[model samples]
Target: MVAPARLDLDQRGDTWSSLPDHDVDVLVVGGGVTGAGVALDAVTRGLSVLLVEQRDYASGTSSRSSKLFHGGLRYLEQLNFSLVREALRERELMLTRICPHLVRPVSFLYPLKHRFWERPYVTAGLTLYDSMGGARSVPRHKQLSRTKALRMVPGLRKDALAGALLYYDAKSDDARHTMTVARTAASYGARLLTSAKVERLLREGERVVGAEVTDVESGETATVRCRVVINCTGVWTDDVQELAGGRGQFHVRASKGVHIVVPRDRINSETGLILRTEKSVLFVIPWGMHWIVGTTDTDWDLDKAHPAASRADIDYILEHVNTVLAHPLTHDDIEGVYAGLRPLLKGESESTSQLSREHAVARPQPGLISIAGGKYTTYRVMAADAVDAARPDLASNVPESVTEHIPLVGAEGYHALSNQVETIALRQDLPAWRVEHLLGRYGSLVEELFAMWAEDPSLKDPVPGAEEYLRVELLYAATHEGALHLDDLLARRTRISIETKDRGVTCARPVAELVADALQWDSGRVDDEVKAWEARVAAERESQTEAADQEANAERLAAPDFRNRSVGRALA
Candidate 1:
């Protein structure tokens, strides 16, 4: 097994310095899941690779997703059987072999409104769903009477359903999973850089060669020469294709998806809920101590960096989910709200929900490949397809992708370690639940956290407002997990922003102070970081009250991004 790569400021400097020295076989543009998957696939296939992201890893659509790894059950209703099968296969791989520590089974109850036809109609679809992916990692679907269903989910209104169907899917912390994939690729000799933007593509007589990248923090530029460039930027696909000096084969449309997080006690359900709406389906997903209920689909053309959820978007979710709940939720019950954009391949359908979820791979020109329009569940398949499309430009002996057989860093001995949780907690002088939490997030990588705790026992103490996460986890984020700013730690690494009612403002300064030494931040810099986060939270709160997208977007953009060099304050 390859030794894990430490992704910190020191390694980032080393990678940036070595950029002008050598040419790589493939240069990937984007740092989301697909880009990370492409890097892992390309490097493991014996190609020298470099992956660059304009912001932090999974800071975009990847981090702000439904956080489920399931076959789109609704796709089966659309008769898109092939896409469902492929996603289901990948879901099984993630559950058993690839990242067992990160992905786990989650059950959702599908309520039946009609008394007769709905039961068999849904039963056939679920049976097909259970059989399509070959070997299953989770149990099959089970039918429940209305009384039994109400007992299972006591919060459901008695009149909302005549019966229900319970089926299994999987969920994960998407940001952490994507970062781990990037780290796993780095462990296999791939170079990775965050806060680096690709200014332009290097061209030699219309044949693409490399890219000119700029450091977002230092304002320094470097020319990186490579054989081929894979454009995996999600919503910004068109923008990057313009850098290549041509229009892509297909256009990408950005669809806005918004979610609201509320405390778990507000919802009385052991299993998650799935509801059908006029345009699309809604998921009431169970997120640790909070319930993530949302996703309103609408066209968004305003700000791409931070999509804002307006009053209407939140009301739409509440109206739909409240139809089945015994107690309705209000704005005051919501702890947090977030918005993300989906990169859908533009089609004849006017509705964004009607757009295709299947991905496409196109060689728009020689030495360049553009991949767009896929669901999160099928990222590995999309990466494999994108790399396969580059084979003609690559060497003759370039091997096929071997990522299917390779386990991610934390998956090596995760199951064995999980069995010893009680013993580990006893030996470490910690509670059993804390050990379980660490094991679920880090898997066998918990050993690394143990080493830190051994050095400083105080690191085991919990954060001030976000007690669910230990101080050691925040230190690990700065020292090893490549967190450049306080937002990166509170927002993505630990999920303090959405999990807390104050949106991480109460703990922002304390967290900044805790990670100051590892990130080399001075006292003034610490104050600046905390202020930036507070401003962001304030903007989001103001934006959610607006009625229109234009108003909401302007409100959200009032906060200057600390990572943007134009803001004149570099958090990096």
Candidate 2:
């Protein structure tokens, strides 16, 4: 196995200095899960690869997902059986072989409104769901009587359902998973550059050769030459394709999905809830210490970076979810709200739900391939397809993607280490639950945290305001996990930003202090970082109160991005 490359400031400097000198085999132009996956697939295939992201990794749709890695149960109704089967297979791979530490089984109860044919019909669909693609790790669906269902979820309205169907799905911390994938790719020798935007596609007489990249941090431009470039820019797929000198083979429409996070106690259910809505499905998902209830599938024509969930969106979710809850959730019950855009393949149907989730890979021009419009569950398949599209440009024999067999860095020996969590906690003089928490996030890689703890036992102390995460983990995020800013640490490395009641504001200053030295931020710079994060949180909160897209978007953009100002300040 190749040694993982350090992705800190030192390595970033070294990588940037050396980038122009080498002819990269593949250059991936996005840093979402799909782009990260493509980089991993390409690097493992014995190719020199580089991946670049404009913002922090997974800051886009990848981070804002329902956080499930599931075979979409609703897809069965559409007769998209193959898509369901393929997704199930990927879910199995994630649960068992690849990143078992990150992905785990989560059960959801589907309430049946109709008394008659619903039971048999739903049971048949679930049976196919279980058997398809040889899914074994997750248990099959179980039919429960209305009484049993009510007992399981006391918060659920007794009249809401005649019965219920319980089935297994899987979920992960999507942002963390995406970052791990990027790090795994780096481990296999892929140079990763975040905050780097591709300004233009460099072409030699229309055969695309490379990209002119702008280091968004410093405004430094570098012409990165590559044999083939793969565009995995999700919602920005069309924009990237246009930069490559061609309108893409297929268009991608953006579907906005909004989710509100409420405290776990707000709902009395032991398991998650899935409800059928008029436009699409609604999920009352079980997040740690919180329940993520969401997702309106309306078309989005506004800003892609920060998709704001308006008051109507929140009301829509609450109204639909309240239909089944004994004590209906109010605006005050919501702790956090987030919105993400889905890059759905454009269909003739006006409804976004009717649009296809299946991805397409097309070499719209020589030396360039674009992959877009896939669900998060099927990212590996999309990556493989994108890599396959680049085969024509390669003179050397490109090896097939072996990502299925490759366990992510932390996945190796994760289960065995989990069993010894109590022992480790005893030795480290920490609580067992804290050890378990670290194990779940870092897997076998928790040893790094332990080593840090060994150096300074104070590292075991929890972060101020956000006690769920230890101080040492914040340090690790900066020193090891390539967290470039306060947002990276608060938002992705740890979910303090969205998970907390204050939206990480109270902890922002403490977290900034924790990584200030590592990131070489002066006192003023640290203060600026904290203020920027606070402003961002404030903007998001204000946006949620607005009624329409225009007003909501305007509210969201009210806060200036700290990164942009910081970059300019540094350069000056």
Candidate 3:
């Protein structure tokens, strides 16, 4: 076996093409959760896999989630039994067997309007939800009186509901989990490349054998051969299928879900609050130092790449969430704003919100398969099914997926290490909170981060602007994770984009420098990286101000690559 390249080896070019002129067992497109999971599953089963993405990993909808790894409680309201059961199982698998470090327990209070009727109604649903996987490790729902609910979530309006239901769901940093999955896949032996767009699918008669991919970073193209090509492009499933010669069995519709991040102090909350909106659900989720309040559902017809959160969209969130807050939050309270497109299964509906989150898998042709339209909670099932669909085309003895049993890179022994955080902190001479923070993000892998700091104590300090994140993390992003661009390091690898006031603009150059040194990038490359990132921020800011989705799409598409040097002091 070829030794795995250090994840920091600038995963920017054709690592696959260098080895041999051979066909891989599977080719997975899209680097979102599903695609990443599929790569990991396929590789674990002893299948040679090659996965490609047009942009950075998690650049699309996968990164911009409400950060929850929960079974859809709202879906229970819709009486979608099968979907709920499947999601609950995946949620359990993630929390228990897979990504324990990345996925954690989060509690939400469900406000009940009509004192008696609502409580019983919600309680029955909660009972069944908890019953899935037969009483999860997390706490079951507790009935809260109106007064008790108010105390738990002080922000809720006084007269909104007679009572609320407090239930347990899972939440995660979506980008981190997605990247870790890809990294885990790499560790197991999968060749994954980001910013390498599939120009066209390579085919044998009507069946896809592989893809003709173009490296978006280096401007190089390579023909990668594979036996089965799985399209897991989320919202871009249709596009990927069409590139595979229009053979995919199902189509995906892009539903826009926008989220806003605000300071924690804005709303007093003992538990994260989940409320029902007219069109969708609104969650005041408890993120580390902030509260994630948002998710406006609307149909998106504009730019699939870089979907912008418009003023109206922001207003819609602020308006609805404000109604529930004791002290209403405004534009001033918004620390970060992001929008993601959901790949809802296309069907007969003008409203995207009503569409199903259930995933569809198909072997449209002999060697081509596509999986699309599922919530993050169900990504594992979606991926396993994709691999199952590709089984007939595979040449090797297909082993059953072991991902359900394999812990992610940082997950193994995480619990024991977390208990020993204080000892780890004292030995390392770091703050207990800081060490704990590292453990939360990296799990047992906190030792790796501490080791990086040990080699050079200077790495212990935080970045100039994004102090919430350490400088060592930037180095780790490139070295241990396959971070190829400045934006990739900051935006996906770290929460710098939402954590800071400048939205990672101020730290871009320094972070770029850190990445360049690690990747051995020359001066010309540094300049290019910096320019592209600045342009990306500028384009996003410009796009957010547009009147409608079309105009916003037009403005955002103007900056294809994220590193434009132009554009100044923008209102985030």
Candidate 4:
């Protein structure tokens, strides 16, 4: 079998040099999960493909999701059965066949309020949810008494629950999952480019034949030719649609969802909690060492790129979540906070929460196809639909998407590697738990890390400020994971940005230096990268203190982007 393509700097240069020589069958704009999925789907169908993103992969909503692969239990209240069924099927695929290393089953507790009706209501919904996709991997819903519920979650006030019901869903690190999808696409011969922004659609008369892509890192431009261009720009869907010509068929409204991460000790619960709000539902998800409690759904009109979690947003989440807690949490308990925008298909409803999560694919013009408004769980389905929509422009017998049977990289030998974690740990001279951690994050790819460590014994040491990660991870991110900027390494590649209390500020310099070695950067470039990342974290913290969205946006925009700053300084 051909070795998987490495997305290092060397491969990036080779990809750019070869872009002009070949006519790609599909040109995918965006680097989120949906875009990555489209690239994989198109390429596996025997099509030459090129995918470009303006920023790091998953820097947008793809990274900042609620981090759940749930079937949307709340959707059942709206009676949206089809959407739920599709999502549940995808969730199962991720857990079992696709990327099991990334996605895993998680249980959530639904506290009962009324004595009689609530138990039956929640039980019925969960039963339907379990049987929807023929799910067998996760355990089915179990009914619990109030005494049992209180025993499980001692942090919850005794008065809060009449009883409870436990049900299973799934979760993953959103950014990691998206990046894995992109890497999987690259493994199948799809050309992946980051920091390559589409300046304009390259159109012949009225049909978009290709795109004039500009390198954000350097002031360079290239016109990439393709048979069809698929736009999967999420919240920026309307913007790209306008560039293609006009908004076709529908409009996408941005809905902001904010989540706060606190240390797990604060929430003394064995299982995650799902609470009902006046408008929607709230989830307290169990992250590794943290409890991610949040998500306020509201309309957002300000900047889609940098969706800030304002003081009001943070307070709103705390107030709602604190209602049932025996010990109330304050700002001091929050280690990390993040906000993401959902691209909802607009409807007559005034509330953003009421907007349909269903997606739409359209052939706006001859060579241009756009897909918008789908959940992260259903990205595979969306990709298949996008490719199906481009059928007229593609070959008469373009093979159907076969991604359903294809497992992502690192998934092939994962189970065997998992069983031998202790042996691997002993051989590598690391703790068993540390080896387990690496397995979950990298799966069978941990062998690559071990190989690197043999070459340089120092690579096994933990990072200076962040002891949870190894120094080799930084090197791996820069060398193999297409992490171009320091922000890419910290924010998306590792999630050190939002997982740490200091927002990765303390480890920024050391992490930058480690990446610089892999990327062959000079001292001045390292300094610039570190400075840019520090400024970004500071801006996010400052923005969170602001009371309004406008203020928060202005604060966030004040920080110079890492790429633009480096480019400007180099030119000067």
Top candidate (TM-score): 1
- The CA-based lDDT of model 4 is what? 0.89
Clashes of 3: 13
lDDT of each: 0.92, 0.90, 0.82, 0.89
Error of 1 at 550 (Å): 0.5
Superposed on all Cα atoms, the candidates' RMSDs to the truth, in angstroms, are 1.3, 1.6, 3.0, 1.4
Model 1 earns a TM-score of 0.99
The collision pairs in model 4 are none
Q: Each model's TM-score?
A: 0.99, 0.98, 0.95, 0.98
lDDT of 3 by residue, 122-143 (tens): 7898999999754377998898
Estimate, for each residue in 1-572, the C-alpha lDDT of model 1 and write its tens digit. 77888899999999999999989999999999999999999999999999999999999999999999989889999999999899899999999999999999999999999999999999999999998876389899999999999999999999999999999999999999999999999999999999999999988887799999999989999999998999999999999889989778988999999999999999999999999999899999999999999788999888888999999899999999999999999999999998999999999989999887889999888889999999998999999999999998789898988998888888889999889989999999989999988988888889999999899999999999999999999999998888898889988898999999999998898899999999999998888888889889999999999998999999999898979654435433
Report the Cα lDDT for candidate 1: 0.92
Residue runs of model 3 more than 4 Å from their true location after superposition: 1-5, 10-20, 563-572
Compose the digit string of candidate 4's lDDT tens values, residues 286-312. Answer: 988899988999999998878988999
Model 2 TM-score is 0.98
Task: Locate the minimum summed-lDDT window of 10 residues in model 1.
Answer: 563-572
Candidate 3 — what's its lDDT?
Answer: 0.82
Cα error, residue 65 of model 3, in Å, equals 1.2
Q: Clashes in model 1: which pairs?
A: none
TM-score of 4: 0.98
